[model samples]
Target chain A: MSECIVITSGKGGVGKTTTTANLGVALAQQGHTVAVVDADIGLRNLDVILGLENRIVYDLVHVIEGECRLKQGLIKDKRLDGLSLLPAAQTRDKNAVTPDQMRKLVAELKEHFDYVLVDCPAGIEQGFKNAVAGADKAIIVTTPEVSAIRDADRIIGMVEAAELPEPQLIINRFRAKMVQSGDMMNKEDILEILAIPLLGVVPDHEDIIVSANRGVPVAFDDESLVGEAYRRIGRRLGGEPDVPLLDLTVDDGLWTTIKRWMGLAPAREVAR
Target chain B: MSNPAPARVGGGAPVVVRTLSAQSGADGVIVSVRVDVAFDDVRAELHRVLGQTPERWRNRMARLDLGDRDVELFDVRRLVHLLKGDYGLSVTAVYTTERAVHRYVSRELKLQVFTRDPADDCVQALVGAVGEAGATAVTEVGPHAIDSDGVTEIVSGPAVTVEDTTSFETDDDVVEDDGAIADLSYDDESGAAKAAPEPEPDVVLPVEPMPIRIAGGQRVQSIPRSLRGGQSVRFPGDVVVYGDVNPGAVVEAGGNILVFGALRGLAHAGSHGDEAAVIMAFDLRPTQLRIGGRIAFQGLEDDIPRGPGFRPEIAFVTDERIRIEPWRGRLPTEQVATGDAPPSTKTPGDAAEAAPVTEQ
Candidate 1:
């Protein structure tokens, strides 16, 4: 059965698009036919992040208006045959396509693809509504900062109002060092405020930025730790409940253990 | 507009066809037609009357008046069908002196019928006003003319003497404006009829002072989700928000406001000058708050201490200034009105009792 999941966040620059792209790649890698829809419209970035921006001859608006066939507008991923990208139109705004139109498109896409991942825009406006309109589930991405957590809370309420099932949270760009030093909010603090199911966390990593800039999703990079996090999230999304949540604490091989033994590093809490 | 004169039909005896306009109690205009001839003559007279009237007044409420005549239901139904189907008039009322015809029209046809010699004067006035031509329907004396004495007697009777010692002056202005003239006047009389349970203000208000919760109880509008930036909801009464009011969002109400979540946005309660209205929220970190004539502007950097923990607070107008108190089943008396009153002799018990009751 096809499942539509919208990746949304009320705050901008919180990695909703990146999460959608990586999740799409990871799901496709598992042999599932996936269609990643960019619901951002005027601020389309999913195409560029998926390295399929140059291949778009027809966009979401064209497909919705019947100017182009759905297959014609779908840009097949260069790396994976099972994966495709429905690019948003750069010329049109969020209001160009309504929630009803988006629902119809998602319903049609569900007939062909096993997974339809909708990349929602930043604000909880028309773009967010369009993305969540047809989704069976939702994934809210947020940072550990107060502002991000607050916005995430607002988004969770909005998603609930849209009648979508309670969304899972993904803490993006988390800094273990800051959390350990009490400089930033810990996972527990964020969890207490959001009070949603935890999907997976992607720690702050430079490789993710580099991969995004290269138009390659971090999920495809085997050597990248962040990519592995995306893989775990994808498996969880694929109904693999046994997949362990990523540990945001520093995981520097034998160094951390040796330092702990030598009393050089502070004792690690094994509460979990 | 003189009542349409009786028109004469050629070949047959002269057919008397008269059309009269009456005003229903509900302010709707009702046109009545009296036919003193056969069914065929009535049709011809109706056509002549319809031709004489303007198009705007054609499809108005029409009533067929059979003055003391025993007409058959079939012929009446046919005439009603002609009025409704052909003339496009909504035949709501049927005036006939026959009791069987009245009962049939009221029951089977489901039309209002007024028989001759209406028992009650009030009912007579109402029925007479509906049947009589000219602007008598708009005279506003139909129900009042009969009920005025009963009302005044009930209002100025024992209840007025045993309770309020002050001279009561009836405010006639309250009688106008709202269409619930009958209900409101009755309520006013009943309110005066009841013995005053507590000492009230000197000026006798037409209506009893209603509790905010009961009077406008269902007027509570709720925003089930967070109001994002640039979004706003304006309600004429109390508002309850289940989600956070985001920084740039706004929620305005004409009465008390309650937020189940954080109030980070601009919230204005008591918008229409109800100073007693209060705004309560789980987290009251609003950017700005306006209650009636008072305004409280709070910034992000403003240091409102929450010592150990933050509790839900209520913002209300106290001594003509905005005061926010940690709502722990009641407003804290220790928490003095900031920027206005110092620690006063009023204890917490006094504050708790004073929160709900406000003197005019």
Candidate 2:
């Protein structure tokens, strides 16, 4: 049966949309029909990230408002065969979609797809409610930073308040080298604060930025470390065994070490 | 101007002293005497007015010139005293050494002089002259003290004594002795309206009549309202409902809940925060349920189960995970009954409970 999963993080800029795009791509690549619905209405960016902005013939608001059929609004992604998107309307506000309407839409999608991943907006406002309304489960994405973890904890409380199924945690953009150097908070510390089951850790990587800028999700790039991380997160969503996080630290050679000591050349940046 | 006034009485003298008769000013009496004396005499007069010894005065006087005249004065203390005395009169001293004469005059003086006989009559006449709006001037003759009693009588209102006129009544007149303003009437035949039954002294009925033991050596502290048959139920501990619980019903217990029935109404388990608390219904349907935080229907779904033992259930989360589980046929009863239900217990059953009929 298809499962409606909402990827939500209470704090903004915590990789919620990125996770939704990558997970949907990863799920679709595994031969499962997947639909990524962007719940952030007026501030729509999911279509841009998926590089399907120009292909949008109808939006979610038009479908919900009865101006367009649900099938008319479903944009099939050319990158992946089974992957489709229900882009949020940039012209309309969040009030254009009701939780009941979202529930009905997700229910309809559940019949055809193996996964319906909703990209919830930041904050615990109406957008969040609309996104989480029809979800069978949730994936809370958070960074290792204190504020992000705190917000994730608040989101966990909210998800629990909604009485949805238990949510899994995906710690995104973790800096392993910084964690080793004691400069960054570790995954264990994040889990201690959030107190939710850990699904996977996504390392910080420049390729993720490159892929995001090019409107291609990192999960599609098998060679990229962050891309592999996104694939592991997708496998985890499919109830696969836990995959170890990537080691992002750069090895120091003698010349590199000497340059580091001389403060001439910078130390290697961590990879995702 | 006729004959140059035959050189006025104290004119052209370095020191001029004028003593006018008492009937000169507007009050018909000159209470102040102006004297234009030498600097030394002026200093002596100042010392006298201030009741200070002449030795206390400084010899070197400060010279002050008014227009073209120079006057030497020791201090301004004497002028201050004259202004504050009878009739509130003031004086200005002028010493014209260049002109060879000093002129001194009372700046503004109006005094009422007193006579020994018919002194009260003069006082009365002064009072009448001042009336309510004009200035009232009264002078007493000799060393006699002024009668303050008459002034006090005219200014003050008459005094009267107040007594506590409130009367007391016997208890019989006031029925229902609580003293509240409720209608208090004593009908001899109708037994003195009982004191509204002293609020039935906080009867602490045992909330938990019987406790049921669950797993982990934790006992269900209160009996489940479902088993209690529809009685206004309150459990001292946790209540476990085993059947379809009804609405307009209450289930309060001290421990936790494991309902095999569809929980329809208010279900409060661990009314206190026994972090080990939980609430699990087979159908998992309820109007409102509270383990701790107030929970209302976030949304209602029609696909919920209706009958008993159709779906297994368990709920428990303390500072960590809040979970619900469906009873699989293979799982032990104690596993579902205890607070330590497995995380994987939530399963979708084919025989889903019918939609809970919620009372509007």
Candidate 3:
């Protein structure tokens, strides 16, 4: 049986699209056929992130409207054979597709793919409704900011209202340096607010941004730490019990290393 | 687009108009007039609606809702004149999203102008409000009006009196209209004519009390464990959390909220718009806090100190802005008298008494 998962965050710029692309790539890398559907119709970036925008001949709307067959609209990812994308129409708005239509589309995709990850748009509007409608599970994405966490809480409530199972949380762009310095919010703080089970924490890395700008999923790059986090999260979703959450603690300088070896420094204590 | 043929009396084109009659707090009726076209072009429609309204509704007050359009002073004055003079509808308030229209309606005409939410659908809004008051025996009216009996159904009967009274007291229109009247009488004209005669007999409009009843909720819902993210708890009266309100959790109450532990999630008190409602916690580091209509998010201040020094804080709406201060057991009346002046000592007591009402 295929599980349709919606990756959503109520606040904008909280890495919902990035998480969607990386997870799709991670799952596909594990030999599972995965389809990442972009539900953010007008503001689509999933195809670009998956490096398959140029290969798209027909989009989701075209398939839904029966202008093209579903096979014609599914753009195969350049990196993986098992992964594909059903790209959103950049010209059309979110209302172009209804929740019932999304359910039918997901049901069809279930016949071919093992997992379907729907990338939801920001806000609790038509886009959000359509994204959660077809999904059996939800993956709420948020940063370590109070504003983002607040929005995540709201999205959780909405997902529950939609009758989707308890959504998991992914904290992205987490900077341990700021968190240790008592400036930025930490994992504990975030977890406290959104009491949902933690999927994994993707540490803040500039390579993730660069990969996105270059039209590539960071999970494809072995050198990227965020990619490793995504892979572990992907394993966790695959029902692996032993995939530990990422430790985003900053390890800088020789003194900190010495303090760490001696077990003298508190975990959250900053070196500077 | 071709304009509809002009109406004989108003000389403006006949536009589609929708009039909604709703029950007021007082033993009377409140009607809202909605125009589909521009505010300036709604003269004929308003005229038609007002003309057809039953004579029994003559003394009732009505609000003009200018959907998505600004109102000029001339247009507002004309509507007010038509409603009050010809129809005796007593145009007391106008609702619009346009700032200029709000200014003209409030300042120039000395009437209340509510800043209507842009997302509000007229028919649905009335129905939603009526749905909340479903306990009140609603009667069917005309085709458009959801209630069939009458708008004044709640007025004569004591069955749904308390809730309706609460609704009336919190009704922004009644309070705003009273405020408008007070403002006009207190300004220039009253000062100029003070010595001439009996000081324009304080227009004792039966305005509801300022700190509207922060009392009488029989039950308090208590949560034993720390609320985790993705969890939500809502109660009609007060809510007491024995544990922390963790991040991503939501706790909403109609009255006030008291958290024995840290409030790190979204906490909303007075979800029904009672400005007197307050949210108090041992260490209030809420991601977002809402009291009545005012909302405040965390990180608004760059220098907010967290941990150990995390003093128990109380959040309440003051002068329309959500203000947070250390919960010092008692409201610092002398401090407020010397500093702010408006929120006196009683406010602190009111806040304390508001939540503890349902406490066993």
Candidate 4:
């Protein structure tokens, strides 16, 4: 379906851009024309994660200012079919584009793409307002912590106030062992505080950082657990039936135990 | 002029059109028109009269006599416009007996109007002194206008009141000026009658002085959306919020405060010191509750939902202190009151004396 969805977290450093890039790749890989827009005007990271940073010529501000056509500003990914990126201007501030311009841009993008995912900036400022102006749905990302959950609750209230449909939640960087050890909140706790539908959870993994450093989305890696989590999320958004959550508990698998007994791997989970 | 001389049409039959005439005096020239016929006939008659009068008379001040015939404001304004604009006649006063015509002429047209019977002797003598067309009598009758040349003397009309004469007294130069006649004799009975077109009946409004909550009340201020942190609302009446009042928000009302959702902020009802005002909310985990002048700091333990069920609660003043209770959906002292109140219905705030009903 032709729709625009904004991914936002009220607080920063919560994996919002990572989730957006992965979902955009996974959706485009499913043979759907998808456009991922970076709504963060000054601090843009979506193009870097999508590995299309070097191909940027005309950015969002240039298109809005009539300096370039919408097609000219859109950077299509050569690595994947039916995937494009609209990078934000890094030198300009959020005030460079208003909410009305973003709405018009999103509307024009929706006319050409099957899915338009907007990576919203942090906080409830003008940037946040501009990102959600034309979005038909919202996907809220929050980590399993009190501060993040509180901010998520506030964001939920704001998203509902903006008149979008009830946003589904993405519990990012969830650590099951932390919950088991009483060191962090569980998914149920975050869901109870935010009061939204749980879309999918991405376990805390090193693949996200590695993939981000290499300027590639983790969802392109088939064997990566985080990639599977994001693909399931993309499938759910595409009307796929519910898939079971990933097992993120301590490494007690038979293969892992045999490896540890053979002295090939460490007996304890590695410290961060 | 001589009443248009009763001219007949070419067929030698008398048409008997409405008459138009003019008389001049030191008070002003009076142009009386009997407009009881069609507007076309009045226009033709006015054109024929102006054709016969001396052209210099158009520059002199003129008072129009509407003469007991009902006239609309449109016809009056158009007639005045024709005399003032087309014929160049300066019309400053009007004489009409109808209150509606008088009100229109005096207030809307801003002209002096005399609302008396036309057959009065003072008006006739005043007409007689101005009988000799444009004669020398300065009929601006005052102590200064007495018998200036003796040939055209000020024949003070018998019906002229002392107050009328005193008000008409002007300087010697007033009779020579064009604008002096405009302010003559309009603040009399005519101005008072024109002030009220339809007589209004006396109305007395009932005022209430009590601060108690009656069965029916006054205005209720409503906020339809949630109040985020740092947002505050203050109202002089009862306040009803359809959404949550989040932490760090404040809501103060002179009457009862009602929140449809959670109230985790501070709420002060009866800010004007009406002690009966109560604060009600669906989730009443407030940081502080103040009713009237008394403030109560809420216990922090209730910040989390203590049980599985969520019920609306109420806070009100009890024994000079605030008391929070699980609301039973109905006021304990309120009766369904079908002709007679229930025996358990005490005063409105007597919740401590009655068994509260289960919340709906």
Comparing 3 and 4 on DockQ, the stronger one = 3
Q: Which portions of model 3 miss their true places by more than 4 Å?
A: A250-272, B1-360
Window of ten residues with lowest summed lDDT in model 1 chain B: B153-162
Question: For residue A162, what is the lDDT in candidate 2?
Answer: 87
- In order, candidate lDDTs are 0.66, 0.54, 0.66, 0.67
Q: Tell me how far the alpha carbon of residue B197 in candidate 3 is from the true structure, in angstroms, after superposition.
A: 36
TM-score of chain A of 1: 0.94
Interface RMSD of the predictions, in order shown? 4.1, 16.7, 3.9, 3.6
DockQ order of candidates, top first: 3, 1, 4, 2
**Individual DockQ of the candidates?**
0.09, 0.01, 0.24, 0.07
RMSD of each: 20.0, 34.9, 15.0, 22.4
Candidate 3 per-residue lDDT over residues A58-135, each given as its tens digit: 999999999999999998886698898999999999999999999999999989999999999999899999999899
TM-score of only chain B in every candidate structure = 0.35, 0.28, 0.41, 0.35
Candidate 1 C-alpha lDDT tens digits along B276-352: 56788988889899875467999657746445578889888767688888886654443333222331454222232
lDDT of 4: 0.67
As for lDDT, the candidate ahead, 3 or 4, is: 4
Candidate 4: regions farther than 4 A off: A181-183, A245-247, A250-272, B1-251, B258-262, B273-276, B287-305, B309-313, B317-360
